[model samples]
Target: MRYFIIPALGLISLNTYANVIQYFTGISYANPAELFKIKQTELIIGGTGFHTVGKFEGSVLNFNTGQYGEGSAYTRTTSLLPYGRIAKRFNEKTVFAVDVTQPFHSNLNWDEQAFTRYAATQTYLTDIDISPRLSYSLSKQWYVGAGINLNFLQNNETNWALPINPTASANMVNRTTGFGTGYDLGIYHVFNQSNFLGLVYYSAIRQNTSGTSMLANRINPNLQFNFSLPATTVLSYVHLFNEKWLTNLQVFVSEWDVNQYVRFINTSAPPPLNPDFTFTMRFRKSAAFVAAIRHQYTQKTGLTLIGVIDHGPEKDEFRPLNFPSDTQYFLALAGDYRVNENTTIELLYGYGYEKTFMNNHVQVNGQNLPFTTGKVHLSANVVDLRLKIQA
Candidate 1:
């Protein structure tokens, strides 16, 4: 059950608008090799809730003269994520598990009075993944697992854009829902009773989505697009120094660049209308590193501390008002306590701080706006609780 803390640490939130590593950073909820070794049926349930509050201050360039003036933005948001997993031991050499978790979720709401409102007043994206896996023990020290994932995605955006009429602006609303599939492969090795290593790879999934385009009524039937979810790879090493101390180190890479383009297709439009139109945001690949330490304080209680650093996605000169992300640092602490022979509980708290980023200019409705310089800073925290049942 101690391994549960590893993934919970990632529940911390910050400016991860592109591809939040926390969502896809963990191996299977319960390692197959570990489950085989324990030879017990286990069920796990947990949830994390994050409350984020921050300020964005920057300057917008005047359209006519390119002069810059300073302005500030503020936002407050809350995100709740819940997950469940069940691991079954078929026999000594075979183990199986199924997990349902939130892989991606983002919600941003900016002050309506800020200059950035024209680009994005509010935006939201949510995703869920269901994975079923089976593992086979190759030998006493080696085990391999494979699984398939079914993913569901949803996106919503609200902003003010240029209307056909030059005298007034129109409020725009867009919504989309999609489904995709992918696979997972993993290998686990036990060097000794106290040392272990694991590697896992998750494949990319393609989403072909169709949704209502209320603003594009002139374009005919509606809107459809292709969006690719990124692939991820994680390597975890666990070491037990003694009966009272343990440590884990994890490094992961996310190929967010696979999400190259989001081309919108309007099949009902005129002959001159092309099916492919590029969206505004461009995402880049990134990586994350985490180090965690656990200590047993008593017969039924333990404490763990974790530190994380994430390399954010590459930034573009044309910033998406709703998507402001950058490199970040996070710190977390967890407490695990055994309430009975069959039940255990864990509580976690985490904090995240992001480095400030700058943008020289912004584009809205095909019009260029210059800012002497604009910057964004973000910070967030999370609280999580988990329960484990073993038989």
Candidate 2:
């Protein structure tokens, strides 16, 4: 006979958690299912700091190796994003929760005199999500959950202000803001004492943005645009090998193809010259795989190791300077400590690596311009700290 003691909420899957700076897979927060799993009323606060550094080595106009100066080397930058969640159990079978998280964010800055200024100098994006969720214990072994999301988005970019002339290049800014809505559905099943499966789905949203565009400090009111955030689905499984050892498996699929193009409409008071601007962005469906292991070395301490690989979405078409993404891989180590009966602290360290394929072609005004380019190398480290208090 085999006997496995299952503690109150022992060996929960950790795959539901995501890397703080993952390649563009739309904006999604850590699965809320994990928050309600143990039926503990708790408040969790966490923050992630991602230190990213990269360089662009190739020529902007497909010329000689030294055609452009060393300005292509960018300076390192770090971004901090925070998240908070609170879950309360109204009854043994019902749970309510609220979450505030930064779903998607990025800031790419280049050297002030980078030759790529004509193409791109800087781009910043921010997305905030507010969610409310409800979970029901359908039965002893089954559970269901649902939630709604309100997302606010912002886009800001800076580049050479040249419209038709390349010699008269100046600094310019383009900015916009919008909002959207989405929903989430989740299911969890405990087949036996040692096995568990969880699934979640998040819907897509469309944002229509309008803002002013500045050229050398001059404002232009013809900077309205629109884009779509893709939907996502995740599946996770957990297996307990013994009372002290456990493993988790996770698979993610995101529909990122909807972000193919961004169309700018001129809404100026008086008709401006060429009030319509359209640009193409190459994006495709993507998937990722994750595996993790956890060991409860003692009653008060736990250690976890995680590895992830993402098959990023990209196309042969011209890649933009703002959003540079490719296949990504990561390794992470984490530790959890229980300070007391009502408090827990978790700390994580992760490293991410990516190499983007060279864009052998460029696009302008829906026209394809051929050029041989060099590869881009990107790397970042993410440090996360979280405090959870059970009330």
Candidate maximizing TM-score: 2
- What's the count of clashing pairs in each model shown? 1, 0
Error of 2 at 170 (Å): 1.6
Writing each residue's lDDT as its tens digit, candidate 2 over 1-391 gives 1111111100000011133254222124455555456456878888877788777776654111213333345647787778888889988888899888876676777664566654556667777889998888888798888889998886644333233232334455667788999999988888999999989988988877778776654567757767777788889899999989999998878877877666656522122224455555556887888889999989999998988888765564445555566678888888899999999999888888777755644443344444325566778787888898897
CA displacement after TM-score superposition, residue 58 of candidate 2 (Å)? 0.3
Cα lDDT of model 1 by residue, 272-298, tens digit: 323334554456787888899999999
Instruction: State in Å the error of residue 221, model 2.
Output: 2.7
Off by over 4 Å in 1: 1-38, 61-70, 155-160, 216-221, 265-277, 280-282, 316-318, 360-373
Error of 2 at 118 (Å): 1.9
TM-score of each: 0.84, 0.86
Candidates' RMSD to native? 8.7, 12.0
